[model samples]
Target: MSDLPVVVAARRTPIGTRSRAFAQVRAEQLAGPVLRATLADAGSATGRPLDVADVVLGNCMGPGGNPARVAALAAGLGVGVPGVTVDRQCGSGLAAVLDAVTAIRAGDDRPRLAGGVESASTAPTRSVDGVPYDRAPFAPAGWPDPDMVEAAEDLARADAITRERQDAHAARSHARARAARDAGRFDAEIVPVGGVLADDSVGRAEPLLPRLRPLFPGGTLTAGTATRISDGAAAVAVVPHRLRGGAAGLVVRGHAVVGCDPALPGIGAAPAVLAALDAAEVRTGDVAAVEIVEAFAAQSLAVLGRLGLADDDPRVCADGGALALGHPWGASGAVAMVRLFSRLVRAGAPAGTLGVAAASVGGGMGVAAVVEVVR
Candidate 1:
């Protein structure tokens, strides 16, 4: 245990709908406060101020400057700690977490702050060679690099996922999230941001599911089934197990990142999950909880099928998912981590409970990790 790495604290801001509660907040502004809060929590829990060696944050469409450095400075972490910004698209946040664990595993032993942040409302317009575009090119010319929604539509057609199923799944997500919010289940992990104590994007809107139209012609991926753009930030405090003191959290067991057909990016999570589970020496049945980003209902359903899980598997996103909470792009993966922390630590999940966090990336990639709750 002394040689392993463990999460000491995890916290995330209330997810804000795009152009709504967090429209005016910068990416750094969102991340810095969460980082500070996470550090404060970790410090109190461990009975000492954390000596974080570095800070790593993920961002997608934020400004060109290094947002992680800006966030660390904004958090008043001082000039001693450096920062790195990761850009693995949707997987960036989880990848940042894995990077911190990797550093700890390689004998660094020092604490590190890792998570993600996104400010979709304030994201700068991206362009290729000065030609304004909605997103930067992910693949070279002549390769099938359809937009994410188109890729989800492809998955839906290939996997025979219907609009009905997608809508049903989205509705279930909303109901579960609303129930959790009403029960105050999220209070332990969510840190207030901009005076928002609960996820502002979640609401009772199951009736609106059928009314929303698809992004493409005759496509099944509708606005109600897919996650909308959102703004948020999340932070995790990671340290060697020897330094964890008495705090109970998830022990870093294993991780994997895998690539897939860029044309069907939605299927990436399945393989990544399998690989990570194999590395962790655990089977799907051994997992007590799961958190997979709901990039789209079609893709999420496809991943579930590939992983041999039912659409409503009790172990998968049991509380809710991106479809209900909103997708803050780079921040979502870390949000998944925070969710795991809530379930395995704050919720008093039994010791040795296995949990997994996974996400499908924009460029036909996926990232996954396996963790075990420890006391």
Candidate 2:
């Protein structure tokens, strides 16, 4: 395997709520702003204009053409930079990040700009239930389950997960999110878009709390605890090392992608993380933080439970999670990585401090990467 690239710059857009101003924005609109911000961040970090070797982007939906290419142009990027799009359902962003890292290690590219943007505002057709098909007949042969939530619910039942436990986990996510946001931890990786300064929304016009109580019946997972249907886009970037430090946060230590049974859908990420750790030759406890894509309350909790992690890891869904923060399919992974790296940078963690990012795909597939914060 090639050595991990030196990540020069990364930036993410402020997440917005469903039907908010960001809802009408195109991937070009979202991706362009962050790309410029990334280069700017790169210039400051390295004290020079980054010669981007490649661009890898993640987006679940957007204008038909290459949003990455459109973003490059919108950001005034030059032609020598080749770009590719990655889609793995909601996991595309992390996948793009891994692909970029893999390329850098293999000497295929240097100083690459890789990240993702998900414009839920422009999401293509999907079932009201978020399934990929309108009718049973439209399903593919041997198609695994289409809905992640349903599979998670099934996993809960099979594992005998109690509703009370699910509720508590959801609450913890919100409380941590509240604390993190209040503490400005999110500011590390977020760049305010050029045109917008603050987020104003109907669902998130205020803090998450009892007001969301009504959203989750039986108090199993309160709206305050769950991620909302928010519209937003975000990006992160990587490049080769001549090393000038931005914060010297992390080096891409090792990355691996593994497959698992698709029957349980979201549960696939569970094995994916384990496999990545084994592949990277790192132990679980050695990791300082873990960012598993929480598609649902149960799915998020399920992975931790399987790994024997209790509610408190100081690892956060702070700022909430997909249930509360909203899941813009394509941008979710990049957002998760941005959050993890930002947290590590703030804490001044050591090289031994490892972080994991995982996401689930339709038809029971899951993918993830392991990053070591190389200070």
Q: Which candidate ranks first by lDDT, i.e. highest?
A: 1
**Candidate 2 residue-wise lDDT, 97-204, digit = tens:** 888877876776557777788776666665656668432221367756445545666666767776666666666665566666677776667767646543333234
RMSD of each: 1.1, 3.9
lDDT per residue (tens digit) for residues 249-270 in model 1: 8887889999999999889889
lDDT of each: 0.90, 0.68
Candidate 2, which segments miss by more than 4 Å at Cα?
124-139, 194-226, 243-247, 316-319
After superposition of all CA atoms, the RMSD between model 2 and the true structure is 3.9
Model 2 score (lDDT): 0.68
TM-score for each of the candidates: 0.98, 0.86
